[model samples]
Target: MYSSLTEIFKILGIVSIGSFSIVGLCAFLFKKLFDYYLKEELARTQSNLQLKNEKLKIEIESTKQNKILAFKTLHEERALLIKDLYSKLYLLKVEYEKIKLQETSLSFEQLNSIEKECIEIQKVVGLNRLYLTKSISENLNELIKKFERTNEILKDLFSIGENTFSSMSEVSNYKPDQEEIEILHEKLISLISDIIELLDKLEESFKLLLNIE
Candidate 1:
Protein backbone atom coordinates (compact mmCIF):
# COMPACT_ATOMS: atom_id res chain seq x y z
CA MET A 1 0.00 0.00 0.00
CA TYR A 2 2.82 2.45 0.85
CA SER A 3 4.58 1.93 -2.51
CA SER A 4 1.30 2.41 -4.38
CA LEU A 5 0.62 5.79 -2.71
CA THR A 6 4.15 7.03 -3.54
CA GLU A 7 3.64 6.15 -7.20
CA ILE A 8 0.29 8.00 -7.28
CA PHE A 9 1.76 11.20 -5.76
CA LYS A 10 4.67 11.20 -8.27
CA ILE A 11 2.26 10.94 -11.23
CA LEU A 12 0.15 13.86 -9.93
CA GLY A 13 3.21 16.01 -9.47
CA ILE A 14 4.33 15.46 -13.13
CA VAL A 15 0.88 16.26 -14.40
CA SER A 16 0.75 19.53 -12.51
CA ILE A 17 4.19 20.62 -13.78
CA GLY A 18 3.21 19.86 -17.39
CA SER A 19 0.01 21.91 -17.11
CA PHE A 20 1.91 24.89 -15.67
CA SER A 21 4.44 24.75 -18.48
CA ILE A 22 1.72 24.74 -21.13
CA VAL A 23 -0.06 27.74 -19.55
CA GLY A 24 3.18 29.72 -19.31
CA LEU A 25 4.10 29.03 -22.95
CA CYS A 26 0.62 30.09 -24.16
CA ALA A 27 0.81 33.30 -22.19
CA PHE A 28 4.23 34.18 -23.66
CA LEU A 29 3.04 33.58 -27.24
CA PHE A 30 -0.04 35.74 -26.70
CA LYS A 31 2.08 38.56 -25.44
CA LYS A 32 4.31 38.41 -28.52
CA LEU A 33 1.34 38.46 -30.90
CA PHE A 34 -0.25 41.43 -29.13
CA ASP A 35 2.98 43.40 -29.31
CA TYR A 36 3.42 42.72 -33.06
CA TYR A 37 -0.18 43.75 -33.83
CA LEU A 38 0.13 46.94 -31.82
CA LYS A 39 3.30 47.94 -33.74
CA GLU A 40 1.64 47.28 -37.12
CA GLU A 41 -1.41 49.36 -36.27
CA LEU A 42 0.75 52.30 -35.17
CA ALA A 43 2.80 52.23 -38.36
CA ARG A 44 -0.33 52.19 -40.53
CA THR A 45 -1.84 55.14 -38.68
CA GLN A 46 1.32 57.18 -39.15
CA SER A 47 1.41 56.42 -42.89
CA ASN A 48 -2.20 57.52 -43.30
CA LEU A 49 -1.52 60.75 -41.44
CA GLN A 50 1.42 61.54 -43.72
CA LEU A 51 -0.68 60.96 -46.82
CA LYS A 52 -3.41 63.28 -45.55
CA ASN A 53 -0.92 66.03 -44.83
CA GLU A 54 0.48 65.84 -48.33
CA LYS A 55 -3.00 65.99 -49.85
CA LEU A 56 -3.81 69.11 -47.83
CA LYS A 57 -0.66 70.84 -49.03
CA ILE A 58 -1.55 70.15 -52.65
CA GLU A 59 -5.03 71.55 -52.19
CA ILE A 60 -3.66 74.74 -50.69
CA GLU A 61 -1.30 75.25 -53.61
CA SER A 62 -4.15 74.75 -56.08
CA THR A 63 -6.27 77.38 -54.32
CA LYS A 64 -3.45 79.89 -54.47
CA GLN A 65 -3.04 79.31 -58.21
CA ASN A 66 -6.73 79.87 -58.78
CA LYS A 67 -6.58 83.19 -56.96
CA ILE A 68 -3.68 84.35 -59.12
CA LEU A 69 -5.57 83.44 -62.28
CA ALA A 70 -8.61 85.36 -61.14
CA PHE A 71 -6.47 88.37 -60.35
CA LYS A 72 -4.94 88.36 -63.83
CA THR A 73 -8.34 88.22 -65.47
CA LEU A 74 -9.65 91.11 -63.44
CA HIS A 75 -6.53 93.17 -64.11
CA GLU A 76 -7.20 93.21 -67.83
CA GLU A 77 -10.76 94.37 -67.42
CA ARG A 78 -9.72 97.06 -64.94
CA ALA A 79 -7.14 98.41 -67.35
CA LEU A 80 -9.80 99.06 -69.96
CA LEU A 81 -12.07 100.65 -67.41
CA ILE A 82 -9.35 103.03 -66.33
CA LYS A 83 -8.75 104.03 -69.93
CA ASP A 84 -12.41 104.84 -70.45
CA LEU A 85 -12.44 106.95 -67.30
CA TYR A 86 -9.39 108.88 -68.44
CA SER A 87 -11.00 109.66 -71.80
CA LYS A 88 -14.07 111.05 -70.12
CA LEU A 89 -11.94 113.21 -67.86
CA TYR A 90 -9.99 114.53 -70.83
CA LEU A 91 -13.16 115.49 -72.66
CA LEU A 92 -14.46 117.40 -69.66
CA LYS A 93 -11.14 119.14 -69.21
CA VAL A 94 -11.01 120.22 -72.83
CA GLU A 95 -14.49 121.68 -72.76
CA TYR A 96 -13.80 123.61 -69.60
CA GLU A 97 -10.54 124.99 -71.01
CA LYS A 98 -12.43 126.27 -74.03
CA ILE A 99 -14.85 128.21 -71.86
CA LYS A 100 -12.10 129.47 -69.58
CA LEU A 101 -9.71 130.70 -72.29
CA GLN A 102 -12.30 132.19 -74.60
CA GLU A 103 -15.95 133.22 -74.42
CA THR A 104 -16.86 129.70 -75.63
CA SER A 105 -19.54 127.39 -74.31
CA LEU A 106 -20.77 123.83 -74.51
CA SER A 107 -24.45 123.43 -75.21
CA PHE A 108 -26.73 122.70 -72.27
CA GLU A 109 -27.40 119.25 -73.68
CA GLN A 110 -23.69 118.42 -73.88
CA LEU A 111 -23.08 119.61 -70.32
CA ASN A 112 -26.02 117.59 -69.08
CA SER A 113 -24.69 114.47 -70.73
CA ILE A 114 -21.31 114.92 -69.04
CA GLU A 115 -23.01 115.28 -65.66
CA LYS A 116 -24.81 112.01 -66.25
CA GLU A 117 -21.56 110.33 -67.20
CA CYS A 118 -19.98 111.50 -63.95
CA ILE A 119 -22.73 109.79 -61.99
CA GLU A 120 -22.24 106.61 -63.97
CA ILE A 121 -18.53 106.75 -63.21
CA GLN A 122 -19.21 107.06 -59.50
CA LYS A 123 -21.21 103.86 -59.67
CA VAL A 124 -18.63 101.93 -61.68
CA VAL A 125 -15.68 102.87 -59.48
CA GLY A 126 -17.05 100.87 -56.58
CA LEU A 127 -16.85 97.67 -58.60
CA ASN A 128 -13.18 98.18 -59.36
CA ARG A 129 -12.42 98.79 -55.72
CA LEU A 130 -12.42 95.06 -55.08
CA TYR A 131 -9.60 94.39 -57.53
CA LEU A 132 -7.37 97.29 -56.53
CA THR A 133 -4.61 97.19 -53.98
CA LYS A 134 -4.92 99.41 -50.93
CA SER A 135 -2.73 102.16 -52.29
CA ILE A 136 -4.38 102.04 -55.68
CA SER A 137 -7.83 102.02 -54.17
CA GLU A 138 -7.13 105.11 -52.10
CA ASN A 139 -5.54 106.99 -54.98
CA LEU A 140 -8.32 106.06 -57.37
CA ASN A 141 -10.92 107.20 -54.90
CA GLU A 142 -9.13 110.51 -54.57
CA LEU A 143 -9.32 111.03 -58.30
CA ILE A 144 -13.00 110.15 -58.34
CA LYS A 145 -13.74 112.65 -55.60
CA LYS A 146 -11.90 115.34 -57.53
CA PHE A 147 -13.88 114.46 -60.64
CA GLU A 148 -17.17 114.76 -58.79
CA ARG A 149 -16.11 118.13 -57.46
CA THR A 150 -15.27 119.29 -60.97
CA ASN A 151 -18.68 118.15 -62.15
CA GLU A 152 -20.30 120.19 -59.41
CA ILE A 153 -18.32 123.25 -60.37
CA LEU A 154 -19.21 122.75 -64.00
CA LYS A 155 -22.90 122.65 -63.17
CA ASP A 156 -22.74 125.84 -61.17
CA LEU A 157 -20.64 127.58 -63.80
CA PHE A 158 -23.04 126.66 -66.58
CA SER A 159 -26.08 127.70 -64.56
CA ILE A 160 -24.65 131.11 -63.81
CA GLY A 161 -23.41 131.67 -67.35
CA GLU A 162 -26.68 130.59 -68.94
CA ASN A 163 -28.79 132.77 -66.61
CA THR A 164 -26.52 135.73 -67.20
CA PHE A 165 -26.64 135.25 -70.97
CA SER A 166 -30.46 134.92 -70.99
CA SER A 167 -30.80 138.13 -69.01
CA MET A 168 -28.71 139.94 -71.67
CA SER A 169 -31.32 139.13 -74.36
CA GLU A 170 -28.77 137.30 -76.56
CA VAL A 171 -29.18 133.50 -76.87
CA SER A 172 -26.19 132.94 -79.21
CA ASN A 173 -23.71 135.24 -77.46
CA TYR A 174 -21.34 133.76 -74.80
CA LYS A 175 -20.00 135.95 -71.99
CA PRO A 176 -18.64 135.40 -68.43
CA ASP A 177 -17.66 137.68 -65.57
CA GLN A 178 -13.93 138.34 -65.92
CA GLU A 179 -12.98 137.97 -62.24
CA GLU A 180 -15.16 134.90 -61.59
CA ILE A 181 -13.99 133.29 -64.83
CA GLU A 182 -10.34 133.76 -63.88
CA ILE A 183 -10.86 132.24 -60.46
CA LEU A 184 -12.72 129.22 -61.88
CA HIS A 185 -10.11 128.62 -64.54
CA GLU A 186 -7.34 128.55 -61.96
CA LYS A 187 -9.29 126.18 -59.73
CA LEU A 188 -10.20 123.87 -62.62
CA ILE A 189 -6.61 123.70 -63.81
CA SER A 190 -5.40 122.85 -60.31
CA LEU A 191 -8.03 120.18 -59.92
CA ILE A 192 -7.12 118.65 -63.25
CA SER A 193 -3.49 118.52 -62.25
CA ASP A 194 -4.39 116.81 -58.95
CA ILE A 195 -6.47 114.19 -60.78
CA ILE A 196 -3.62 113.49 -63.15
CA GLU A 197 -1.22 113.03 -60.26
CA LEU A 198 -3.51 110.60 -58.50
CA LEU A 199 -3.98 108.67 -61.72
CA ASP A 200 -0.23 108.29 -62.10
CA LYS A 201 0.06 107.05 -58.54
CA LEU A 202 -2.70 104.54 -59.11
CA GLU A 203 -0.96 103.17 -62.20
CA GLU A 204 2.25 102.80 -60.25
CA SER A 205 0.45 100.97 -57.47
CA PHE A 206 -1.11 98.59 -60.01
CA LYS A 207 2.22 97.77 -61.59
CA LEU A 208 3.77 97.14 -58.22
CA LEU A 209 0.95 94.88 -57.16
CA LEU A 210 1.35 92.86 -60.34
CA ASN A 211 5.16 92.76 -60.10
CA ILE A 212 5.30 94.39 -63.51
CA GLU A 213 7.13 97.51 -64.76
Candidate 2:
Protein backbone atom coordinates (compact mmCIF):
# COMPACT_ATOMS: atom_id res chain seq x y z
CA MET A 1 0.00 0.00 0.00
CA TYR A 2 2.91 2.42 0.74
CA SER A 3 4.52 1.76 -2.65
CA SER A 4 1.16 2.38 -4.49
CA LEU A 5 0.64 5.69 -2.62
CA THR A 6 4.10 6.95 -3.60
CA GLU A 7 3.56 6.19 -7.31
CA ILE A 8 0.14 8.05 -7.30
CA PHE A 9 1.71 11.07 -5.55
CA LYS A 10 4.49 11.28 -8.18
CA ILE A 11 1.88 11.11 -11.04
CA LEU A 12 -0.17 13.97 -9.50
CA GLY A 13 2.96 16.20 -9.21
CA ILE A 14 3.76 15.68 -12.94
CA VAL A 15 0.18 16.55 -14.02
CA SER A 16 0.24 19.85 -12.02
CA ILE A 17 3.55 20.94 -13.64
CA GLY A 18 2.17 20.16 -17.17
CA SER A 19 -1.01 22.24 -16.56
CA PHE A 20 1.04 25.22 -15.33
CA SER A 21 3.28 25.10 -18.45
CA ILE A 22 0.22 25.05 -20.77
CA VAL A 23 -1.32 28.06 -19.03
CA GLY A 24 2.02 30.03 -19.26
CA LEU A 25 2.31 29.29 -23.00
CA CYS A 26 -1.24 30.49 -23.60
CA ALA A 27 -0.60 33.75 -21.69
CA PHE A 28 2.60 34.41 -23.74
CA LEU A 29 0.75 33.90 -27.07
CA PHE A 30 -2.06 36.23 -26.00
CA LYS A 31 0.46 38.97 -25.05
CA LYS A 32 2.22 38.74 -28.42
CA LEU A 33 -1.10 38.94 -30.35
CA PHE A 34 -2.26 41.97 -28.31
CA ASP A 35 1.05 43.80 -29.00
CA TYR A 36 0.82 43.07 -32.74
CA TYR A 37 -2.77 44.41 -32.95
CA LEU A 38 -1.80 47.60 -31.08
CA LYS A 39 1.13 48.21 -33.49
CA GLU A 40 -1.20 47.81 -36.53
CA GLU A 41 -3.73 50.27 -35.09
CA LEU A 42 -1.00 52.86 -34.39
CA ALA A 43 0.38 52.50 -37.92
CA ARG A 44 -3.09 53.06 -39.47
CA THR A 45 -3.65 56.19 -37.38
CA GLN A 46 -0.24 57.61 -38.44
CA SER A 47 -1.01 56.98 -42.12
CA ASN A 48 -4.39 58.73 -41.87
CA LEU A 49 -2.75 61.77 -40.24
CA GLN A 50 -0.14 61.96 -42.99
CA LEU A 51 -2.83 61.88 -45.70
CA LYS A 52 -4.81 64.67 -44.02
CA ASN A 53 -1.66 66.81 -43.68
CA GLU A 54 -0.83 66.37 -47.35
CA LYS A 55 -4.41 67.29 -48.36
CA LEU A 56 -4.23 70.50 -46.34
CA LYS A 57 -0.92 71.45 -47.99
CA ILE A 58 -2.42 70.95 -51.45
CA GLU A 59 -5.41 73.11 -50.56
CA ILE A 60 -3.14 75.90 -49.30
CA GLU A 61 -1.17 75.87 -52.53
CA SER A 62 -4.33 76.00 -54.63
CA THR A 63 -5.63 78.97 -52.67
CA LYS A 64 -2.37 80.87 -53.20
CA GLN A 65 -2.46 80.25 -56.93
CA ASN A 66 -6.06 81.49 -57.14
CA LYS A 67 -5.10 84.68 -55.31
CA ILE A 68 -2.25 85.31 -57.72
CA LEU A 69 -4.54 84.83 -60.73
CA ALA A 70 -7.12 87.22 -59.30
CA PHE A 71 -4.51 89.92 -58.68
CA LYS A 72 -3.13 89.57 -62.20
CA THR A 73 -6.60 89.93 -63.69
CA LEU A 74 -7.25 93.07 -61.65
CA HIS A 75 -3.97 94.61 -62.76
CA GLU A 76 -4.72 93.95 -66.42
CA GLU A 77 -8.17 95.53 -66.10
CA ARG A 78 -6.67 98.61 -64.43
CA ALA A 79 -4.16 99.01 -67.26
CA LEU A 80 -6.92 98.86 -69.87
CA LEU A 81 -8.94 101.48 -68.00
CA ILE A 82 -5.94 103.81 -67.88
CA LYS A 83 -5.32 103.41 -71.60
CA ASP A 84 -8.93 104.13 -72.52
CA LEU A 85 -9.06 107.17 -70.24
CA TYR A 86 -5.89 108.63 -71.72
CA SER A 87 -7.05 108.13 -75.30
CA LYS A 88 -10.40 109.76 -74.64
CA LEU A 89 -8.73 112.77 -72.96
CA TYR A 90 -6.31 113.20 -75.85
CA LEU A 91 -9.10 113.05 -78.44
CA LEU A 92 -11.17 115.60 -76.51
CA LYS A 93 -8.18 117.97 -76.40
CA VAL A 94 -7.67 117.67 -80.14
CA GLU A 95 -11.35 118.38 -80.81
CA TYR A 96 -11.25 121.45 -78.57
CA GLU A 97 -8.19 122.83 -80.40
CA LYS A 98 -9.88 122.28 -83.77
CA ILE A 99 -12.90 124.29 -82.59
CA LYS A 100 -10.62 127.09 -81.39
CA LEU A 101 -8.83 127.18 -84.74
CA GLN A 102 -12.21 127.49 -86.54
CA GLU A 103 -12.68 130.94 -84.90
CA THR A 104 -9.60 132.36 -86.68
CA SER A 105 -10.54 131.05 -90.16
CA LEU A 106 -14.25 131.59 -90.67
CA SER A 107 -15.27 129.22 -93.47
CA PHE A 108 -18.63 127.46 -93.39
CA GLU A 109 -17.21 124.25 -94.97
CA GLN A 110 -14.30 124.26 -92.51
CA LEU A 111 -16.70 124.65 -89.59
CA ASN A 112 -18.79 121.73 -90.83
CA SER A 113 -15.73 119.49 -91.14
CA ILE A 114 -14.57 120.40 -87.62
CA GLU A 115 -18.06 119.79 -86.31
CA LYS A 116 -18.10 116.31 -87.83
CA GLU A 117 -14.76 115.51 -86.20
CA CYS A 118 -16.01 116.80 -82.87
CA ILE A 119 -19.11 114.60 -83.11
CA GLU A 120 -16.96 111.55 -83.74
CA ILE A 121 -14.78 112.40 -80.76
CA GLN A 122 -17.84 112.88 -78.58
CA LYS A 123 -19.13 109.46 -79.58
CA VAL A 124 -15.85 107.82 -78.61
CA VAL A 125 -15.68 109.72 -75.36
CA GLY A 126 -19.23 108.71 -74.53
CA LEU A 127 -18.45 105.04 -75.05
CA ASN A 128 -15.34 105.32 -72.91
CA ARG A 129 -17.23 107.04 -70.13
CA LEU A 130 -19.81 104.29 -70.13
CA TYR A 131 -17.13 101.66 -69.81
CA LEU A 132 -15.33 103.54 -67.05
CA THR A 133 -18.46 103.94 -65.01
CA LYS A 134 -19.42 100.32 -65.51
CA SER A 135 -16.03 98.95 -64.51
CA ILE A 136 -15.51 101.20 -61.49
CA SER A 137 -15.54 99.66 -58.02
CA GLU A 138 -18.46 100.04 -55.65
CA ASN A 139 -16.44 102.30 -53.38
CA LEU A 140 -15.86 104.76 -56.24
CA ASN A 141 -19.40 104.68 -57.58
CA GLU A 142 -20.29 108.11 -56.19
CA LEU A 143 -17.22 109.69 -57.76
CA ILE A 144 -17.93 107.86 -60.99
CA LYS A 145 -21.48 109.22 -60.98
CA LYS A 146 -20.15 112.74 -60.56
CA PHE A 147 -17.86 112.28 -63.54
CA GLU A 148 -20.70 110.84 -65.55
CA ARG A 149 -22.86 113.89 -64.84
CA THR A 150 -20.02 116.14 -65.99
CA ASN A 151 -19.69 114.05 -69.15
CA GLU A 152 -23.41 114.47 -69.84
CA ILE A 153 -23.06 118.23 -69.49
CA LEU A 154 -20.14 118.17 -71.91
CA LYS A 155 -22.19 116.11 -74.31
CA ASP A 156 -24.94 118.72 -74.22
CA LEU A 157 -22.47 121.51 -74.84
CA PHE A 158 -21.05 119.67 -77.83
CA SER A 159 -24.56 119.14 -79.20
CA ILE A 160 -25.23 122.88 -78.96
CA GLY A 161 -21.97 123.62 -80.80
CA GLU A 162 -22.93 121.10 -83.46
CA ASN A 163 -26.31 122.77 -83.97
CA THR A 164 -24.68 126.21 -84.13
CA PHE A 165 -22.23 124.99 -86.74
CA SER A 166 -25.12 123.53 -88.77
CA SER A 167 -27.02 126.84 -88.61
CA MET A 168 -23.89 128.80 -89.63
CA SER A 169 -23.40 126.44 -92.57
CA GLU A 170 -26.96 127.07 -93.76
CA VAL A 171 -26.94 130.87 -93.22
CA SER A 172 -24.00 132.85 -94.58
CA ASN A 173 -24.87 136.04 -92.59
CA TYR A 174 -24.48 134.41 -89.13
CA LYS A 175 -21.25 135.41 -87.41
CA PRO A 176 -20.30 134.40 -83.85
CA ASP A 177 -18.98 137.13 -81.46
CA GLN A 178 -15.26 137.01 -80.63
CA GLU A 179 -15.90 137.33 -76.91
CA GLU A 180 -18.46 134.53 -76.94
CA ILE A 181 -16.03 132.22 -78.77
CA GLU A 182 -13.33 133.02 -76.24
CA ILE A 183 -15.68 132.28 -73.35
CA LEU A 184 -16.69 128.93 -74.87
CA HIS A 185 -13.02 128.03 -75.35
CA GLU A 186 -12.30 128.83 -71.72
CA LYS A 187 -15.19 126.65 -70.58
CA LEU A 188 -13.94 123.78 -72.71
CA ILE A 189 -10.51 124.11 -71.16
CA SER A 190 -11.98 124.08 -67.69
CA LEU A 191 -14.00 120.96 -68.44
CA ILE A 192 -10.90 119.23 -69.80
CA SER A 193 -8.98 120.09 -66.64
CA ASP A 194 -11.73 118.67 -64.50
CA ILE A 195 -11.71 115.45 -66.52
CA ILE A 196 -7.96 115.18 -66.11
CA GLU A 197 -8.26 115.60 -62.36
CA LEU A 198 -10.90 112.87 -62.19
CA LEU A 199 -8.68 110.56 -64.21
CA ASP A 200 -5.84 111.16 -61.79
CA LYS A 201 -8.13 110.29 -58.91
CA LEU A 202 -9.26 107.15 -60.73
CA GLU A 203 -5.66 106.07 -61.15
CA GLU A 204 -5.01 106.55 -57.46
CA SER A 205 -8.09 104.52 -56.63
CA PHE A 206 -6.89 101.70 -58.88
CA LYS A 207 -3.54 101.71 -57.14
CA LEU A 208 -5.26 101.45 -53.82
CA LEU A 209 -7.37 98.56 -55.06
CA LEU A 210 -4.23 96.73 -56.04
CA ASN A 211 -2.84 97.25 -52.55
CA ILE A 212 0.10 99.06 -54.12
CA GLU A 213 -0.26 102.10 -51.81
Alpha-carbon TM-score of each model against the true structure:
0.65, 0.61
Q: Tens digits of per-residue lDDT for model 2 on 85-114?
A: 556555555655565566533444544554
Which candidate has the top score in lDDT? 1
Candidate 1: which pairs clash? Answer: none
Tens-place lDDT per residue, model 1, 1-213, is 999999999999998999999999999999999999999999999999999999999999999999989987777776666666566656666655665565434466566666676676667668666755676567657766776776666556555354555543343354546675676778778766766675676566546556688
| Weakest ten-residue segment in model 1 by summed lDDT | 167-176
- Candidate 1 stretches with Cα past 4 Å from truth are 1-6, 58-84, 94-113, 126-172
lDDT of 1 at 55: 97
Model 2 residue 48 CA deviation (Å) reads: 2.7
Q: What is the clash count of model 1? A: 0
